[model samples]
Target: MKSDMSDTNNHGKEISDDAFATLIRNQFQLESLGERLQKIENETATMKDKWRRGDEAMRDFTVITITPTEFTLGTE
Candidate 1:
């Protein structure tokens, strides 16, 4: 009778242990997903910065005009 009782308790503990393991695995997966999302966000920010710099550089450029006697440079 004692052995049977212990077996029953062990069986219950095994089920609970499996549940805990699954929970831990899910937590790790969520952490991994968060890291991936952060990396993507960083990359997107870098691309936006690059585009902004390019736009600013374009704005800084000006056109040059030349007449027979003189030359002029102007920005739009």
Candidate 2:
């Protein structure tokens, strides 16, 4: 129901040929960005699935719980 972006062009008044061309170009740009965002979302979902599987495996084993701030990873 709510609009995400606002359209600036006036529908009643006559628009110049150059303005029409600009509008078409902007619409294509938005389409390209939408495609890119969808691709990223798919990749992120894949990564999350992998992490969830790994966490489940780790939970089946015994682990030594420690303080968050006190545990320094990759450092002896």
For lDDT, the strongest prediction is 2
lDDT of 2 by residue, 7-75 (tens): 554635556667667777999999999999999999999999999998986875425455556677898
lDDT value, residue 58 of candidate 2: 82
lDDT of 1 by residue, 1-76 (tens): 1122234435534345555667568979999999999999999999999999998777665223345346445733
Question: What lDDT would each prediction earn against the true structure?
Answer: 0.67, 0.74
Model 1 segments beyond 4 Å from truth? 1-15, 62-76
RMSD of 2: 10.2
The 10-residue segment of model 1 with minimum total lDDT is 1-10
lDDT of 2 at 14: 55
Clash pairs, model 1 backbone: none
